[model samples]
Target: MGDPTPTNPQDETSTQPGASPAGWWGKLRDRANQLRSARRLSRWFNVDDDKVAEILAEVRQQLPTTEALLVGKPQAGKSSIVRGLTGVSADIVGQGFRPHTQHTQRYAYPSEDLPLLIFTDTVGLGDLAQATDAIITELVDDLSSSSSKGRILILTVKINDFATDSLRQIAVRLRQQFPTVPCLLAVTCSHEVYPPSQAN
Candidate 1:
């Protein structure tokens, strides 16, 4: 399409009539206008419109490759869960009481194509009362590249401290931040810490 011919050139002052020729600020303003015009021209078969199509593609590329995030406070037994799921021994697995894993670590599911599943061991986001932004960012990135067949975010705690303020607060925050991310609450050390309810 041809450029938008104004009825009055002098009237193009205020984005209306009597508008001055674009000054510094106006030039910046007109720059966006020029971009829009260029885009319109592209739509009319002038330039390539492929860039607009790449946004979703890029976001998809940025999604997580793994299916789940195993998050909890330090020493909450997330490693134990990982050991159980992967059949890996704790002797080789990194274990700690606060922030056991400093970063997000991906574990491959034992029996499935495309890795069947991915479990991300996030640092003690809920346990250490730390910011989970980096952990969540890693999760989203992984999801972008891989098919998240299923996501399991486990919030773990010791049986002796199941209802601690930190655990409850973290659970609330996780629920609010990721309303759709599937989650499970686990009370670890049950055998040692808390016997059957009837035992008490």
Candidate 2:
């Protein structure tokens, strides 16, 4: 006891405690597991397998129906969404205002047995005088004559500076024209401007 031995018990790594060590097979198994994880991560560069699986699930759940109209202003992306939903690339619709829809464009969903949904693109409200009147007239005539069930009208508009008289006036007229029918108003270009619900 010439010099007191300083025993630092806190230094656990410095002391060789009697513990069982992992064998060679255990180390090799851990390395293989790490390599497998790295390979799985690397495979995601070309395509996302998770997203593909999700889309396929969505396609399976989607039910096809044939009673609706896509009504919106010009260049409001109605055509784009219609094409996407229907899974068709061809010209399902023509651009300009046609006097009469002799052949109302029908966009078909997958599954041959499913009924094809017809999308009638009406002219922009601003493009014609009393557009609400024209639209209601067409819708009434079509529904009355067709063998199909009642249709749903989906109205799309760009959300921005809606204080103008055009939208307010149109809304009033539409309410008057089809008081009993159901209407769905969809606001597009929402990324570019605030939605009406958030507006002050």
Candidate 3:
């Protein structure tokens, strides 16, 4: 009988431990695809619908997502905060926000497909023409009530706009519903409160 030989650890032909040759090749192909993916959607990297969906599916599997719910009236600096957080131009922020819920619009930082942070802004809040209850209910439903790390609330109120009865009600109800999710108060439009003599 011929003597048995040991597999060489440094052999270039060796497959990974417990992995078949086909499986090892598949893993290599997947890694190559991920490496080729554009970090952001831009002139340098334009992602098609299929590519975006694929990237998003992979990202959801790999990352721990955190949702930031921005509850505020119209023009209450929600977009401003998103701009600051994302460092995207106003044009991109304006275009990026898409319908999340009936009364909420969401923007994912970096790129929608590869987002680490997500911001959901209430669109119909404080508008006389729209019913705020539906919005509140929708926001409540959107809460990731299980994990405190999964979500947080951002309540924005214009500094000079004291008609906060609605905003206050929303904040109180959301806090009660999801006591675990911490709420942050952002008083916007402070420039209106400050005199011209005051430095920024």
Candidate 4:
């Protein structure tokens, strides 16, 4: 982005009078030039650690990111939704997730440094022993603490799976807590409703 301004073709320094005369002297001159270039490069990048961190923080603040929280039972296509949103391969999406809490994982699209969207996956949303109240509390705390404004909740449920008594409770809790946050109902596994011949 920062291209050097062009110098005049007639500029004196632009023209090296001649190639170095061949000898040990030429080799020594080349070595010295290499060292000078290296020093210049090093000096250019010799920024203070604190200053670098400050710049990175500013960049983070400037980049607008949407945060999506995916809450669903097992095999509900939460991972597939992430893959669809990011337009990346499933394996890459699978590997990108980093643990956010005891029961949640986070993934930032493109990169953590400059993400356009960040997704938080609730790991144990519908487990029999899992406490949904704790999950709801954690989500509320996270949403309140986050600097991001664009927050959403995605509820993934398999189309054929009607056993949602537990899932419904969680959805109600989240809606009551974060009324402003938009929610999406992602119904998946339509193949489960079709016969074997039509499933393909």
Taking the tens digit of each residue's C-alpha lDDT, what string does model 1 give over 73-138?
677787788788667677645532223245566555543323544666766455355555655555
User: Across residues 49-90, which tens digit of lDDT does each residue of candidate 4 receive?
Assistant: 999899988888888889999989879999999988879998
Candidate 2 lDDT trough over 10 residues, lowest sum = 95-104
Once fitted onto the true fold, the runs of candidate 3 whose alpha carbons sit more than 4 angstroms away are 1-56, 144-149
Whole-model Cα lDDT of every candidate shown, in order: 0.62, 0.58, 0.82, 0.85
In terms of TM-score, which candidate is stronger, 2 or 4? 4
* Residue 171 displacement (Å), model 3: 0.8
Q: Which segments of candidate 4 are over 4 A away from where they belong? A: 1-49
Estimate, for each residue in 90-181, the C-alpha lDDT of model 2 and write its tens digit: 46333322345532334434432344465666555545554555655665666566453456667677776363354445455555765655
> Best candidate, TM-score-wise?
4
Top lDDT: which candidate number? Answer: 4
The clash numbers for all candidates, in the given order, read 16, 0, 0, 0
Please give each candidate's TM-score.
0.46, 0.45, 0.68, 0.75
Q: Which order, best to worst by TM-score?
A: 4, 3, 1, 2
Worst 10 residues of 3 by lDDT: 38-47
**Model 1 bad stretches (over 4 Å):** 1-66, 92-102, 111-114, 126-129, 132-147, 194-200
Would you give me the overall lDDT of model 2? Answer: 0.58
